[model samples]
Target: MSWRIGDYLDQSDLDVIVVGIDCNEGLKRLDEYGPWKSNEMSDVFSAERQSIGGEGKEYVEFIVHELKSMIDEMYRTLPGETSMAGSSMGGLISTYAACVHPHAFKRVASISSAYWFNQKEIEELIKESDLSNIERFYMDIGTKENTESMTILHT
Candidate 1:
């Protein structure tokens, strides 16, 4: 999927960067379920399906590398000052990136993450991940919505 860098640079000196990773499998599932709007971003990245993998974890790893390179080249941001944020499946990848590549980003904001992917695999990874240098972490989920039903997991 295409990564949409939001207009956060104009509002903060914190160098907030938002990356959108399209999850085709997730989007197709959403289409058959409900809320077609959820698939909009995924649709934009459909043409890039060949660039992504079938495994969610592998896809997340690719996104982490892409984001790090993009930020370093485009904004020249220092690893210690970079922050990443995303919603839903994006949140899952955001958290995965921070946990796996803690030095690439200092802060992570995950909104309604899909943590249920691979069952206990994610939890095991997060538990074993070294996050001593993570400056900040933000996680939130809507009480009105059943995230599990939406294939989202909030940890």
Candidate 2:
């Protein structure tokens, strides 16, 4: 659910392995982790925004915890080296995961995140929390990002 993730990583010339996670249940996963469901930014993307993602933060956290532990055990990974990246709602959750579990994810990239889904709450969350262990963050959005959107992309 991204643009040339592998090719981009290869071009960067960084010796980092890419792990692509598919979001077949994209909206559901977003609601589980995104802590938002206003459906206010329905026009931001072309996908049918039938219903907003549900409030399922606990479920999302549990799943992420389990996945990280399993991946660590199953692979020869270095500590403080995990990263998560995605686009749209995928981007939103990557940011959330890093904020909530910084030790597990040292770097995060949120590409064109659908912050308009629940902008106020996320803004409050950012102000209210203290993030640690995160070494890098990358975020991007289009110049023409939904002029009608309340959470218009600034950059």
Candidate 3:
């Protein structure tokens, strides 16, 4: 997934360290396993649960523990200053990370999230999760996107 975070850095003088990780690796196909999916999904679009490899949780742990440790060794970083953002399936996983790892992902932007993969589960997760740690949360849907998914998101 491509994010325009660089645009923000260019437009503003805010110092940012944007680390991009490749979620599509390990010889697995994109449909087979991806960081964006945290649960099994059997929809008409595809029959694979991208979370079969546990990329979502694994990625969160990697970012919060391993990657953060490495970054801290080099630079002084504040607690709860990390942010995550993505689009489509990537957006889904970003949202998951923010909810599941609030202490790490303080800011989140999920654009056109594919919540339909497990709409009920994600909605329940959002409802059950404590978002007090989040300093900012942003979500958006285009007018030309899936109507049914948009309706569900609205609900």
Candidate 4:
């Protein structure tokens, strides 16, 4: 579980800081999927399939905490200006991070998010969490795919 920060830093000069969290389940799937799977930019099946069990939330929270600490120590960024974005399980985790720690990230962009993770646990979190401070949120998915899981997320 290493994070790539350069992808999100092409257009702007905001002193980008990328935080990577190691979800053991995700790593396990990646191992099974082979290193070549990492080359696919839009694949989320492996991560979504691994989003069951109790450790998911813990991993998300840990990432949020680490992100906060990184922002505080390295960039001096306030929560209102920071943006967090990811795809697939990373998207789900990014959404959870912003929702759970609203004061730490104000902008969230989730592409092909596994919103169905943990049987709507992410939805419940969004419904229950306080989000008065969040300023921006972006969610999108590929429309050509007809998979049921993607359908649910599209809706």
Give one digit per residue, the lDDT tens place, for model 4 in 76-97: 5554566777776667667877
TM-score of each prediction: 0.60, 0.72, 0.72, 0.62
Query: Candidate 1 lDDT, tens digit per residue, 59-153?
Result: 54555677567767887456567777777656766677787788877889888775543336557768999998889999998887564444422
- For candidate 1, which ten residues in a row score worst on lDDT? 31-40
What RMSD, rounded to one decimal, does every model reach?
8.4, 5.0, 5.1, 8.0
Candidate number with the higher lDDT (2 or 4): 2
Off by over 4 Å in 3: 25-54, 146-155
Give, for candidate 4, the lowest lDDT window spanning 10 residues.
Answer: 32-41
Can you write out model 3's per-residue Cα lDDT over 38-151, one digit (the tens) per residue? 334323223543353345667667777898889867877665588888777667778888888888888998988876755676788889999999999999998888666445
Q: How many backbone clashes does candidate 2 have?
A: 0
**Clashing pairs in model 3?**
none
Which residues of candidate 2, in runs, are more than 4 Å off? 8-13, 25-33, 39-51, 55-59, 146-155
Best by TM-score: 2
Models ranked on lDDT = 3, 2, 4, 1
User: Where's the lowest-lDDT run of ten residues in candidate 3?
Assistant: 37-46
Sort every candidate by TM-score, greatest first. 2, 3, 4, 1
True-structure lDDT of candidate 1 = 0.59
